[model samples]
Target chain A: MPTSSKIFISSVAQDAITHLRIGAFEELSRLGHDPQMFEKNFGPWPNFQTGVDHCLKKVSECDLYCLFIHTKGGSMTSNGYTVTHLEYLRAVSDSKMMMLYCESTIMDAYFKFRWIIAKYIEEFKLSQGRMPHNNEVVDFLEMESEKNPTSGIPSKHQIDTYVWVLLHDIVMVKGHYVEKLSWGHTVPWASYLSDLLQQGLQLLPKKSLYEESSQLALAFGDFTSFAKQVVSDHVRISELLEGRRLLNRSIRMLTRSEITAGPVNGSIGSVKACSAICLFHHEGNSLTVQYYAGDTNGNYDFEVGDPSSFVSYTYNNLQDGVPGLFYWESRRLFYLTYKLGEYVISYHFPEDTAWSSQLYADYTDDIINGILNTHANGMIIELLNSLIGGLQK
Target chain B: MSKKPTRLPAAQDGWHVQTTANALSPDKTVIAVNKQGTVLHMQRNGMSAIGKDTLLFVPTTRYTDNIIHHKHQRLNELNNTLTGLTVEG
Candidate 1:
């Protein structure tokens, strides 16, 4: 129950919330706390069911419920992530469980996530005949508000939202901040996290851009996350390569990935392979399965029930077990050799990162796939074409 | 008793007296001639005084020919203060 056992207050994003929590948490911890544990970046769950399962499991055991309530408004989720505001309802029912609210009023991209957490955003609005309680989350936020300067990416907006809610949570819930360590903090984890979060802010714009343009190498139907990453990718590839309109669907493309076995000097290399699953009303019963490397290199053409499928792989060759949502994080190669209708795509994958022939293939695959993966679809082509075509004319 | 010699009524003595009280431009050199005419100086924010108001005498002939056009200073140039330092010739 409320005994002096250690507990964690997790926030989906750390921004300045970590510091506020640290300061307020320190004061509460002085009352014989076991130390607070924080999990950043990993969730309120990235997917629907995952988030629900995670929140359910984590909230079940915690003595306190510190909710960072941001106002991104509401959002829909195909997965179970958005529908479960019931956790807050459950937490409120328990007398033993203390409740803390971190009110978020930032107006930006996080609005979606903020709304995703809305039903429990009591600090912002009155709840069941209750005057909004001031908690630690609100306290820290208000204190930090004194340092506001209205400029830049409006980070102050986010800082304001995060701090207010955190302070509100602590002050109102009378949350006894439990301190102490959890295994989530060791070497690579901490370094990896701090580095990623710090980097993610810088990387997000580009990352999100990359995920937006038609599903590049994405297997999962995560339109939202894909949109974000594509947007980011679009920004990145444009910067990475000088040439725009990088891909023309009509151009010849060769593909390969880091998921098959062999030496890849034109033969095979170590890289995984995937089977194609395609059914269309093109020609006669075109029921053909193609074999491809680990990476989705947009190559290969499987000629139906052909016994010896040759050098190319097609969408019709998806393997038996590969799920539609699974992504093979393998390095692949897509070499655009020819143009127009006679397009030939040779795909390859590297087996390992070692110094063997397979590794060489993966390395080479990285080089080509790096370019291929950066290739844009229609819009990019149109942009490049218009710019160039205008010049040409 | 010798009349205490009136301190030479030099001021009212025959002199070409010119004062803005009757002169053309009161705000400008209201030269008064005391039996002689010459220009004297009285410093003020402006040139002539009409009772209480001061009107600056912007002569048809400039006090000096060197001038800087008074279009508004550029954004960067017009800062809080204008430094008044000048190099000694």
Candidate 2:
């Protein structure tokens, strides 16, 4: 069974029309959730103050805050905040997961009301020194329209479509001024809310509820051992060592980070040890690099022959030189070279400042990873062959 | 009694003259002799007034050539302006 949650539903009592509020509450209960709505739960208290206090207490304890807005704005409290608005404020303060749904349809002279609200958006912007959120800005606008009802009228369809579009924009892209507001028919609204709640529930730790057993522990141990064996069988110890060296060298070269590095896993360091050093030079707002390494005897696409016989070869219509080392070709270029019993050094450079900002600033490790992963040896070999192969008579 | 001593005409008087107006070119000289024998000769600097346009008789040349013309003017002015100023011994 799903974990039962207390969902506090905030809406006007007048929103009971077509059973919108009650329908949502009933749906939540049917889905194994405890729905807290004041409309059905509020009973005759000794005083109105006592009733308000009881409602506030209930809202404070809710796990999720579900707010539905329709035509009626509801009665204002002593602080000039609507009861529903106060509930929303409390929910935000408590950081409860919130789901917002607004109805598109409104009755009683919708056109004149829309015009007043549209004018008030400018007023709100002027007072706030920035544009107001699409949701509340319209609400404030509606307040102004009600005060001065004899103005240009807007079509009902236009207002409804406008609200729907605003809601769509906020829902699709998060971190907007207004977050997660949906305006549509009832069927889609319930489905969307259910999915959102389900996603939130999945983020909760399900494993914590399961009891530990000796059999489960044995199974986990076997799985981990098998996984490690498979990885060792496929990936060479040399490649892992090379990757570790590259990560360490690259991390040391960073002056200020636009891309931060996380800790390198210890598995690579514990395996076959080798010395591979890579160096970076910041020359006039561009990066120049050199990578030096020895004996890479994994099945690579481009294999290094006798380093003494390494000739300066240019191929594929590129600037002619030794395939790997000490060749400068335009901006953002790579070169590789090998020396007998010494080291294989490969260098790559940024072409210009613009390229450097993108490559070095954001993707420094990603670019380096190409030269150091499981396919590192093969990639370099392939790179050299593609260039050198072009030189064949 | 009627003819008060009248002034006699000089020998060079009564020379009928006509002025021909034509734009002068810079690199060539222009010489014109009217029917009355009044001669006109025009030259711009050492160059003729054939094609080059010049406000004065001096030939109008490129701005670059003016550096050679007044190379000493700027130095002379600066020296005169700072005549009293000198480096300390």
Candidate 3:
């Protein structure tokens, strides 16, 4: 009983990982893999050294270490955060510890930097032959040459099909965390992603090569044909929800402020003096952002300010300084926000989109199922993934 | 009789959905509204823009004896009443 190929999940295992881990596991199981054979759990270690030891020991028990690289790995160089770096260091002794980078969508400026990192990672792969997608890495023009086939499938279609088949083989059939660049699941998901980018920007592919690639989903198994399939099977992912959220709260405290010894107190260079605080509550889908602000100047300034507070909510989109596009996308419900660099942006979506409830029920089912079949194997589930698919009935 | 939809001026190819509403509490504030009809509010940071939109609405909560319709709006009126105000980023 080769334990469901114990693959170690890495990276911060937060937002990005959550979206992919589970799908990866389900895909593998469909490929005839033992669903409970792989071990996804890792006992919490107290320190970085202990965690590394635990992680490394776990890797020793598996055939491959599936490392998920999200953005720039981590800031904590000492912690098990550098587990992938350590795996690379130990590559000579353990070449089986393959290092794969899960590529992310990045701006053009960062693309060149990503290339540099990919090159460095390739040098560490320790393989002699050039991998499938590396031609794009080696010379941008080489990609064009591969795209131009005299007949049959065009380059773009072949490339997409190449990635689609490769991903299905590695994830769905081979049941291995290992994958080639031809598969978008592995690092340098360039081919599959470039197609997605082309579609998103409303830009057509360089040729009909890509048009044919759309046939991949239609044809399944050996019997299916490109045209024989009357309907094209495509997957639609519902990411953002739209609707009103009756319950949601967000708070932000001022980081640095000047507290004056004078009467009114919060005096920022002779403005209307406010003392104490200001507060706002965005009730329903409609919300008001209120904060307590104190200002001090003359005695009357503080007097007028009081335990000062004010609230404001705008019913009009124009008043709120919000775009009118996603109103329906969010289903007009719960609030969603993302912090990028210096910008803090927020949006709202319907509450039903929250997967936690479904997640909780599934967890309960897993617990009951695991207890019944305590065959010492305990279930090994991947965290999350899209291509790997999830347990969908 | 047939019902007709009210056509707003400069009606683009998009529908107008309300995101935030504070009309109930005449004494409240709103943070932001996006194209998706999502209302978001935060404290301290007055400069918060979540999504892009053509029209922006900010209720004047702080009105003083000298300044009408709150300070920010009053300031805008002062500049806009004449040669339209140009807010520099």
RMSD of 3: 29.8
lDDT of 3 at B28: 31
lDDT of 1 by residue, B5-41 (tens): 2211221311111111112223332211111222223
What overall lDDT, based on C-alpha atoms, would model 1 receive against the true structure?
Answer: 0.30
Off by over 4 Å in 1: A1-11, A24-30, A34-51, A71-87, A93-96, A102-393, B1-89
Cα-lDDT of candidate 3: 0.29
lDDT of 1 by residue, A108-157 (tens): 22323321222234334433455343233234334434444322212444
A234: Cα error in model 2, Å: 50
Q: How far does residue A326 in candidate 1 sit from its true spot (Å)? A: 66
List, for all models, the DockQ compared with the true complex: 0.00, 0.00, 0.01
Please give the interface root mean square deviation for model 3, in Å: 29.0
* C-alpha TM-score for every candidate: 0.19, 0.33, 0.22
**Pick by TM-score: 1 or 2, better one:** 2
Instruction: Pick out the ten consecutive residues of candidate 3 chain B with the lowest summed lDDT.
Output: B13-22
TM for candidate 1 is 0.19
Question: Per-residue lDDT of A19-55 in model 3, one digit per residue for the tens?
Answer: 4556555654554443211235465554756655666
- Tell me the deviation in Å of residue B21 in model 3: 64
In lDDT terms, which candidate is top? 2
- Which parts of model 2 are misplaced by more than 4 Å? A1-3, A15-18, A43-50, A105-201, A206-393, B1-89
- TM-score of chain B as predicted in candidate 3: 0.25
